[model samples]
Target: MSRSTPRPEPFVSATSAAALNDLRTRLRATRWPDSPADAGWSLGVDVGYLHELVDYWADEFDWAAQESALSRHPRFRVEIGDLNIHFVHARAVSPVGPALPLVLSHGWPDSFWRYSKVVSLLTDPGAHGADPADAFDVIVPDMPGYGYSDRPTGPPLNSIDVAGLWAELMRILGYSRYGAAGGDIGSAVSRYLALDNPESVVAVHRMDAGLPVFTGDRADLSPQEQEFLDSSAAWGSTEGAYAAMHRTKPQTAAVGLTDSPAGLAAWIVEKLRGWTDCDGVIERSFSKDEILTNITLYWLTGTIGSSMRMYNANGSIPSEQHARRVEVPSGFSFFSGDLFARPPRAWLDRVANVVRIKELPRGGHFAPFVEPELYAQELRDFFRPYRKALG
Candidate 1:
């Protein structure tokens, strides 16, 4: 079979002046929600803190600077199947050996912006004092319906469908074989890429093992594994409410999120603070500009609704995909501050061909962006052994 050549076109994100003005107006006119006496983040986003953030977003945050910085990367759009995928195709600048191609997928509440911190570090390791041989030609894509990519107007696309698109994307980019890495929903996408196209994906690395992929009898799992499952359920009871809303009633929530910048920030920033190792201070993990930049992307692109719809699509993935064991070599990194507890080796072994597992001293769910140096080094070490396969 002949591979299709991709017609790549340069892509840049530019929010209209009117849109910026409207966002400011909405932020200024935000309907304030009253907080219970002494209420902090326990009852969702703290109204006090949110008001402060809204003030910064309205009067001080710089969207144009962030947009310009984002456009500095070599971004491009390529048509694949029914969607036009937007991706950053950065090549190794001073290679010492093979510049292995690596595709990185981003999760929700984020776009390709999730990988902006680590792209250059991975692509040119020598500049960062690492072995130039560790360099990778990084490819970070904004999955369909997120960021600059076309949103699904028909049936929502799941991780499986996006994985298929990613496989074809790599093929179209002239990579017959490559490595895959990601976190959050991205972790699931990388797993699906390995499951659905193992021949082409040499190895895969993820921050989380994703929703537990199990098969056979429950009797097979160790007691600790069972406890982990129980803890997951408990976590879901509290942390999972938003997911349920996304799965069942995204449109209801999307209406407010899409219409009001403050509403969107309130929804997304809570997760950012809760899921990160910020010790209850969001500014510890992200600057006001950084936080607002991400929120503003959702606001400007009008993608909050489409992004939420992905949960509905994911909920419908066939049981067989959940049960399918990933045969490709897999690696896992458990960042200490991540929202979900790290799965035991026994649990991960049930789903993937586990080759490496490491627990970092710091970082949380958004590790790639929060701790790019550590995250990039982890990728370099894990994929080091697989580089020969690309030869």
Candidate 2:
């Protein structure tokens, strides 16, 4: 496929500001449901959770504070594949240090907000007391339908296509070669960046990798393989409902999630509860404000339906299915979280030049936000070897 250069666009125009105001109105007008879960957000964002969050969001959460925080970084939009993609661009300041242009992508239920903590650590590491040589020019983007990006006008876009666009985006920013990192859907995008746009990306780092191909001539053999597979099967039976809906009937389900703040909160909160790394619940790892902020982004943008279009567009990309084998140099950090593919070393080595593999002491689906120290350190170490070339 031929690549297209992204045209210029700003982060937030008057349109987005107007939309935010409208969402507050919707939150105020919401009629809560009789929650199925208990008192808190565990069973889902309960009625009380939504009421409390919406109250704070309306009175105190301060959209203005969040907006000003985001505005500190250089924000811009680029027209890619007929869609405007919004991203934050911050160049590293150290002249003596390496400044590889790094594209960091956010996965589902997360906007660019998740990366805000690590941006300064990566780009302005000297100020944060890290080695200046570890600095990188950072570019964090909200996927097509998420955050401030324009809603998908018609058809769904694939993860690989997003990666190709990022390579093109970096070239526009004057980087001939670069590096990338991702988690969850972000990891999928990073894989595409290295695999499809091999000419531009130097190396790739993955915080999460999906279900791996279990190519075994014999079905019953090793204990470890059998064990992990059995656990994965159990997870599929219970927590895989979201995957099914997104895969088959996305648009049909958007009405309820969009109409009521309580409904939207519950729908989004379930994943936060089950998918996180915490022992008890998502609340253990994230605050009610933290959880609602993600939901608010989707509610305000009406991107919930559009975001899920990835599943519909690809229509059952069978779990463990390798759409295309990626041969790029790759570093992997596997967190102790549910639904993580746990790709065998042999399989990843075939599709990628497996340079680093780390087993983190803790973390889950939302790696960066859940365990920033562990996640960011893994990023630092994995990308350390390429510092001389890109940093």
How close is every model to the real structure, measured as TM-score? 0.98, 0.87
- Quantify all predictions' global Cα lDDT against the true fold: 0.90, 0.73
What does candidate 2's lDDT look like per residue over 1-391, in tens digits? 1355445666653336677677677778877667664556544455675577677766666655555665777789977667777898988877355577789988876778778767777777678666677778889988887788877777777776677778777877778878899887888889878877787777899876664445554254355556656666676676777877887888877777777766777677777766766875567888766776677777767788888777676554444535366666789988876456575665566567888998876778777777776766777777777766653
Question: Candidate 1, clashing residue pairs?
Answer: none
Clashes of 2: 3
lDDT of 1 by residue, 234-339 (tens): 8889799999999999999999999888899999999999999988898998888888888888889899999999999999887787877789999999997888
lDDT for 342 in candidate 1 is: 72
- List runs of model 1 lying over 4 Å from the truth: 1-4, 213-216
Error of 2 at 234 (Å): 2.5
